[model samples]
Target: MSEENKKGKNDQFGELVKSMNQFFHDKPVKGFLQTMDEFFRAPFPFQSAFPVEVRESKDEHIITAQLPGVKREQIQLDILDNYVTITVQSHELFTEEDDHQRPVRRRQSMQRSSRTIPLPQPIAENKVKASYQNGLLQIRVPKQKGKKILIEGND
Candidate 1:
């Protein structure tokens, strides 16, 4: 075989390996591996991002978030200036006993996640109400009323 043909074969092999690496690191395969690791590594906490929506009404601003597997007590909401922050903290504990009545395996995991959203306008922080039910967190805050300004145009 000629030297050029050997070089071409080597380059092709390198390109193939690079493409395979890229494919494995891409979203689909990487996400599956992360999910499986989270399931098997009970001693390690896994944090995942959820979805949130903010809506505006005539009188109030409503914020909704989906938080499956999260308890109401694990969630915390805070409003500062025009920004609202949501935080969730969770802990799981598991233990297994042996035939001799001694503890064999014990696992504990703690996870925390937080998200912050800025409102389009200021709100009445003191009047904010929040509720969590059916794995959904909803927050309602009254919008602050702004004074109207009138401008006169010269003819």
Candidate 2:
């Protein structure tokens, strides 16, 4: 009687393990899909919506910012001892008009835009120049030279 009871308990434990394994096997694809969805939904904070470029040379540092539909008056430039700042502001405009033949109203929209950039190195104050052309803003900041110090000891 004791041997029969032990055999019955082992069979029950085996059945429980088999049922748990089947549950996991039936939903394997769901588990994998959920993992992939989480991975793709991760946020990217470092990405920029527009493009910009910066270049440096022996004489000066150059910065070119793209502003497709922006105007010259919408931008500002600020310079300091070791850095330069550029700021652009955006404005919006809306228009509505009625056609003579159809009497239908049409709507149009526009957005104002702005951006700023800070230079890595200080530039020569007197030699800085800036200009805008063909929707591109360019700045040339001349490099400043450092003065050398001479020390002499008493003879």
Candidate 3:
């Protein structure tokens, strides 16, 4: 082939590669790969697992959790022994329409997250108070006085 023909072929090959790269970038494959990479790079125990902070004082224990986009009624708190578990269930619906006014996509998703924290000391279940405000849930439970236990020797 002549020099001009070789240059023309190389230009066409470059254009072909550029177009292929653009096509892949525009497709969902690239997005999926990015999402997967983020998922793997994330630290263990996903962020949606209801991150909580517990503070203990001389009289009471306070627990606070970050729960955005969740309704108060959707949250459930349970105290079993020295463990406190907070669970939240939520459902979201999303719809998209094209220019023609026809629905192009409809998505419904449900998410549930729970986090259990073991208290350093026992609490007074009857005096426990919980409140939710502005996407934050706080629970205050009074600490119980430590009881003395007698150990009996086995005969």
How do all models score by TM-score? Answer: 0.67, 0.49, 0.64
Task: Report residue 132 deviation for candidate 2 (angstroms).
Answer: 0.7
Clashes of 2: 5
Clashes of each: 0, 5, 0
Comparison by lDDT, 1 against 2, better one? 1
**Candidate 1 — which residues are off by over 4 angstroms?**
1-47
lDDT of 1 by residue, 23-45 (tens): 98997798667657867886334
Candidate 3 per-residue lDDT, tens place, 1-155, comes to 89999999999999999999887787377766665685589633325677799998888889999987678988999988888899888776867688998986676667778999899766567889999999999999888887799999987
lDDT of 2 by residue, 1-155 (tens): 69899999999999999987777667566566655675578532122234568898987788888766667887777777676666665544434344655533343333333345566666676788999988888888776676989988897
Which lDDT value does model 2 have at 136? 86
- Candidate 3 global CA lDDT score: 0.82
Specify the poorest-scoring 10-residue window by lDDT in model 1.
Answer: 41-50
Clashing pairs in 3: none
| Candidate 2 local lDDT, residue 143 | 66
Best by lDDT: 1
